[model samples]
Target: MLWFLTCVAALIGGYFLYGAFIEKVFGIKVDRQTPAHTKTDGVDYVPMSTPKVYLVQLLNIAGVGPIFGPIMGALYGPAAMLWIVLGCVFAGAVHDYFSGMLSVRNGGASVPSITGKYLGNGAKHFMNVFAIVLLLLVGVVFVSAPASMLTNLMNDQFNLGITMTAMVVIIFAYYIIATIVPVDKIIGRFYPLFGGLLIFMSVGLISAIAISSDHSVLGGYEPSQMFTNMNPNDLPLWPALFITIACGAISGFHATQSPLMARCMENEKNGRFVFYGAMIGEGIIALIWCAIALSFFDGMEALQAAVANGGPGNVVYSSAFGLLGTFGGIIAFLGVVILPITSGDTAFRSSRLILAEYFNMEQKTLRNRLLMALPLFVIGGILTQVDFGIIWRYFGFANQTTAVMMLWTATAYLVRHNKLHWITTVPAVFMTSVCITFILNNSQLGFGLPMTLSTITGVVSAVAIAALVIIKSRNSGEVDSEEESLQS
Candidate 1:
């Protein structure tokens, strides 16, 4: 109870502070001339009302990753949940808020373009490669986790391979829709419905779980007990906290969101509503999932057994509805479908943006870009058919690495612009150091020397890029002086 209270307080306090000081005081303006900026052709870059943009942001940000990441983190202990909730407000919200602002200021530039402009062309290319790899990894992990959950639900209810078939069908349908449909139409209608359903289901489940449980409704086992049974091989609390907070903290997906959603903002002031608002909403969802996991199961082993035998959806259903009777079961079933749909649509939009940028298509028509992105989708889907666990592990590392790179870029921007706001810098430094430590601590190559070497390389790269920017600024100033001398 104390832990949960602390987390809630932190989130509430941080949101106000960030909104007042960072977002409102230090205002960022949207650039209109950039290629990716909204030209309002009614297809790709259609203008939207603030309310509509807010709705879209909610749907795009609330994916299965936020739900399950907290659940996994809860397995570490109740304390883990506290860290996640706090981190979401302090670190995650700030990242999303500023990243979107930065992108908008530079005319809907993606992370790569922003890096290129502020950092350099090489850094831009590095960020692009990083973004693509991160996207692929994130897509695969998210797809597999939900697929596994859905499979468990289908098997339990229908006694067939419905889950596997559904996974394939959903992926196929997504690609087909992506190939055919326009971005604005797809997002404008589908996202709001998806987000609405998620809110309804989450509320329904939490209410049902609280009423049905025999023990104290909100109260659960202690944080210490939650950790005692966890797998020793699992990473420690700090690193695990970092991983769990990945999307909510600083997702690579924000790059996609920046360009896709920025055009709709009625004013630059609304960036706070779009970015910070979406992140807090995501954090609340994570908190609910953590509560459900802890309330339902006695320990990690029981939860694992439930998942292994039945699937994650089974665990969620059993935990949520098992005590509530028939109606509860039905609600759980519907929630299963809603969860994946929310995630699937977000993935579709993200992939579309990536393709749009790669091909440099006019924002007016995305048909060609959609066609080009189909092969990549199919390839990812095929890879999903093979070993998923290996893919998940790799994805975890890749996602964290991408976050590190983005944080480095954000840090550079702050340093160069002399905007070293503690809200951004402190979390950025902690995340970077924790990530580097985790990589080094886990590496098995040559008594950890190889991991240390890699960490040093990454650090050097970040510093070198920042140094070059400073030097370039100095040289440009010098050139202006020399030109003035000649003119005079």
Candidate 2:
């Protein structure tokens, strides 16, 4: 409980302190015209209130990743708390802030374009394909996971006899409408309510923990526990914990989602509150879920068995229903359901935007919007038919790899301007190591090297890349004319 409170405090402090420094570093132009005004098309680029943009961005980057990922990461003990707090403050929020701000600075370009601008044309071409694939997989995963949950919830709770296939069709239909419609129409209007539910769920669960009579079960942090390998499977903490806790800690996927809100932001001044603040909000959710998971099952042994038996979904449902009571639990359950659905809609919407930008297609016409969106859905719909279990394993790596690219890109941006570059460069190198070690150590993913060798290679490779980026940035000329104009 002491550790949990401290982590929560640190996340909030991070927003005010470190987040402000990032905003200053980016040099927010208060009077500058944002893309929302310059590129307003009443569809993707409409200006929105800061509150709405913040909530939408919150729901966008956050899916089930915060909840499920932390629940899984909790298997590692207090070390999970360490990652969530430090990683969110230093790595995740900074990454998110830059991703959105850079997009805002570049007429709401997608990750591929942003990376391409900094990393080069080759990177641009690669990220175009890489980002689209990641978004599609996210779209499909969100669709299937939520559809199945709704199907079971309706069946078991209300006996509505809703089939998963029917639910999938319903979700996909919503995704299409959400994808093709104007920003202010469906997503802009409804996402705040969904975001409210998410907050309500988090607050209610935390209140439950606070009021519980038994404090011992909630467990305070211990120094010795930090080094203890509490994972039931004896998984190493270095790479496995980092990958498992991506969303709550630092995820590359957030970079893909940032541009959506980047287009809607009315002012550069609100960047910190919207982008970095949203990541902090997500870190809070992740912390609550982790704490609850650590204490909910009586012991780590039972928690592991339960997770193995029914997966994180079962654990979430059971915990919410048990702690929140019938009425509160129902609302909380709906919140969980909303997480993926909201993210799924935005995932598809982002895909459309990225594709439109990639092809230089005009999205002003409803016909153009449909043309870009229809194919993505068709591909996504077909992908829903593949073995999801197989595809999901690759997503973690792809997600982090994209993050690495964005971090390096942000580093390059700073270096080109002759400002602080280490802020991004350090995390960039760290996550590069995490991704490399993960793939190398996992048998199905890489060469199945031993953990020590994988760690060594991962660290060495990341350092080498960092050195090259620093040297190249020193040799690199100036910020592009377009970028200078945007910043000015």
Candidate 3:
């Protein structure tokens, strides 16, 4: 009961507090700034109410990744939960908060556009390629994991022979919705509805579980089970931690979502509410997931067995519902479907925006955007046909790597803009160090260290050099005209 209350309190408290600050400090009047281009149509560029914007942003940002990442991260035991919560605040929330504000101030540009201004054309092109590849990887994995869950549910309930039926249904549903609902309308209504459902289900499940289970319920498991159950090479804390934090801590995907939400902000003040508020809400959700996993699984072996027998989705769902009755299970099952849909919508919309910007094409027509989004849908569908669990692991690794890049970029921006306070530096150094330590320990874990240590070291060194160069350029009064404008 206490745990459940803490989760709710954290969410509510964080939302209002952040909302207040953004309004007070940024004076974020939504109507003061117009979108860069006035090609506004009801489909893609419709304005939204503050409440609706908040809801959609929350749903788009929170997803199955938060639930799963924290659970798997628990392999480092309960201690890791501290990192998840704290990291989100200092590293993740800050990234989202500033990224959104920066985009809005710059006429709703994506991460690449922002990078281009500060990092030069070569870096801009690099970021664009990296962002697209990361998006596809994340999109496919997100779609597949939930589809796999639905497939197992169908097989268990109806003895269906089709292993891929669930995946088909998911893709079909997403396509149908994307075609029918304008991106704006989806964000206005469905996003919040989905977010509300997640909170309700999470609270209900946690409360039910806490009420029913005693301390003795999961005693057979030990803390070391998390590390020992996996190949020693695969279980290194630092590498896994780095990977987990990337997906949960900070994500490039958030960069896409931020600009969309920024366009809807009634005032610049609302940026804090919509951006930072959503992040804090996500962090609370992460904590709840960690609590659930720690409460249910006895050790790593048990978690692995469950995953092997039923897959990760089934293991998570079954455990969540284990403490409750059939009613609880049904609620959890529904939440799983909602999870992927919300994320898919966000990804689809973001991908469309990227394409529009990349090709200098207008997004005035629904047909054109849908045509552009078809490739993403197809790729997600094909990925669903493969081993989802393995795909998810790789996605995790990629997520962390991208986060390091983003944090590096954001840190550079802060330093150049003269906003490099102690708060920023501490979290920046913490996350950067976490990534470096993970890379160093990769050899000891025997995970086949695909990328060489020297190469990783060189990359880190290069980022440091780039940061220095940017600082020197600013000091020497040689900053780019656009970057100077952005800071002012």
What are the C-alpha RMSDs, in order, of all predicted structures? 5.3, 1.8, 4.6
Model 2 agreement with the true structure over 47-153: per-residue lDDT tens digits: 99999999999999889889888989989986787899999999999999999999998888888988887888888999999999999988988988888778878
Q: What's the alpha carbon RMSD for model 1?
A: 5.3
Q: By lDDT, highest first, what's the ranking?
A: 2, 3, 1
Q: Which predicted model would earn the best lDDT?
A: 2
TM-scores, each model vs. reference: 0.83, 0.97, 0.83
TM-score winner between 2 and 3, please give it.
2
Error of 3 at 332 (Å): 2.0
For all candidates in order, the CA lDDT equals 0.61, 0.88, 0.62
* TM-score of model number 2: 0.97
**Any idea how many clashes model 2 has?**
0
Runs of candidate 3 exceeding 4 Å displacement: 1-31, 34-39, 158-163, 169-173, 176-181, 215-234, 421-426, 433-466, 469-488
Residue pairs with backbone overlap in model 3? 28-267, 28-268, 28-269, 29-267, 29-268, 30-266, 30-267, 221-298, 233-445
| Residue pairs that clash (backbone atoms under 3 angstroms), model 2 | none
Question: What stretches of model 2 exceed 4 Å from their correct place?
Answer: 214-217, 220-223, 482-488
Q: After superposition, how far is residue 467 of candidate 1 from its true place, in Å?
A: 8.0
